[model samples]
Target: MPVTLRPLRVAAAQAESVAGDLDANVATAVHLVSAAADWGARVVVLPELFLTGYSPQAWLPELTTTPDDPRLEPLASAARERAVVVVAGAAVRRSGPDGSAQRFTLSLLVVDEAGEVTAPYDKQHLFDTERAFFAPGAQGASIVVDGWELGLGVCYDGCFPEHARAAAEDGARAYLCPSAYVAGSEHRRDLYYAARALDNGIYVVFAGLTGRCGGLDFSGGSAVYDPEGRALGRAGIISPAAVVADLDPVEVARVQAENPIARDRLGSLGGRSRVVVAGPRP
Candidate 1:
């Protein structure tokens, strides 16, 4: 006989954040986490810089969060209570290249089902404007949830094919992208997610921010793309919503077997990008 388990359901979420208001934003995040779990999702990903609302205000010293920051405790508790893994975004501090001062890194903090958080997975690729505000992370990262090895990346990180390819080379079955796209930039999200999924034969989940933040407006385009670059699920534009989908390991294996991209690839030519894995989630 064979052992059987529950289906692997995951969700991508978007919410309108209260700029620079940690209390309100954290509450909204917790609510969304609960909503995802209630929908039978075992893992959930939220938009980038959600805690500080992706505003210019993110550069402020008060907006930085650490893995164990008390402000995120409620969110960890929510994941623990719901028995789901929550990949959430925040502005976290990291030593500057000069090592003289601390700067921010757009990062994802993984909250395991036990309410413990793994160290932040900072964004590896920073957009043009972001390069001035944040220091790019040194490498890629992945986290395990209920035995699924999922890759991690922030907004612009997905734009680079090497980022996702490295994760696939490092054995990630799914890529969780927490992103934010301004009003007219929605098309970029679709193209990148689909490209990444097809290029690496891996599932891609996108969580985008919605509504106004600072002087800009964002259109939520949360979606999930299967290994063949097909849209498996999608959330409405510019409104708070969660895109939920059931990930099938068998389907992933089938795609990889048929495509052989991972096997025939010229030996991880994506250059020195190392992928760090977080673990076997309970």
Candidate 2:
């Protein structure tokens, strides 16, 4: 039996942030979500730590958030009202009281059209500076939307091909990366994103944070690529705006059939296959 999934209209939100300003940041996310929905988007992706900006450790006292953080309600409310799926980022508080409070860079809110949170996926890989303040998430969690499994990663997670390949192995047909990557070093991130899609034969959806934060400027080259490693569309460097593209799972399957990168093929020699990890650029 041939399986099928609905093609999604997806948009990415790029924003200039005010670090540690939770209220204002949430408001800004709400505004972007509304704008994206207006453009007929069925799903929208926001940058990493969007609700409290990218730098939170320096403002720990001001940048606190619970799983049921009230700050995220507006995004859910807008999703429910607009009948769209919203994926917004935030620094999530992870603790059950007795345990110490650890912050995870979370792709916090995954709101369905019914205006309810269907599922939420946190970032598994914490970047260099992020390791100091954010705790890493375990593997295997993914967001299932309308029969398509969407794998979620933030920032540095995109640099790790294994993370994305694991998602594909777990039945993910698409991967969503919400990032706060800066210029110069962004090419490394971009290539890995492309490699993940090409290697796994899945779609890649990347949303990047723009403008400056903590004295560093973000690259903001948000983009989407097909399974064949072809870029469908890109938001361009340093530009902040929303763009939509159609994702077809059938095409992804076709590409996988043709490329067979992730498939194990039988050989005359038998029981041997080579795989390698491409490292970060200089």
Clashing residue pairs in all predictions, respectively, total 0, 1
By lDDT, who's the top model here? Answer: 1
Candidate 1 at residue 28, lDDT?
92
Model 1: pairs clashing at backbone N, Cα or C within 3 Å: none
Segments of candidate 1 deviating more than 4 angstroms: 1-7, 95-101, 267-282
- Cα error of candidate 1 at position 180, Å: 0.4
Q: TM-score for every candidate vs. truth? A: 0.89, 0.86
lDDT of 1: 0.85
Candidate 1 lDDT over 1-282, as tens digits, reads 755433489999998987788778889999999988889989989999888778876567777777867888899899989999888888887665897888778888888899998655889888877777778888889987666778999989899998998888898889999998998877777899899999988899999998888877888889999999999878867456999999888888889999987678785467586686877789
lDDT of 2 by residue, 58-121 (tens): 3363475764666667777888888888776776666647787555545455777776663367
* TM-score for candidate 2, residues paired by index: 0.86
Top-TM-score structure, candidate number: 1
Which 10-residue window of candidate 2 scores lowest in summed lDDT?
Answer: 55-64
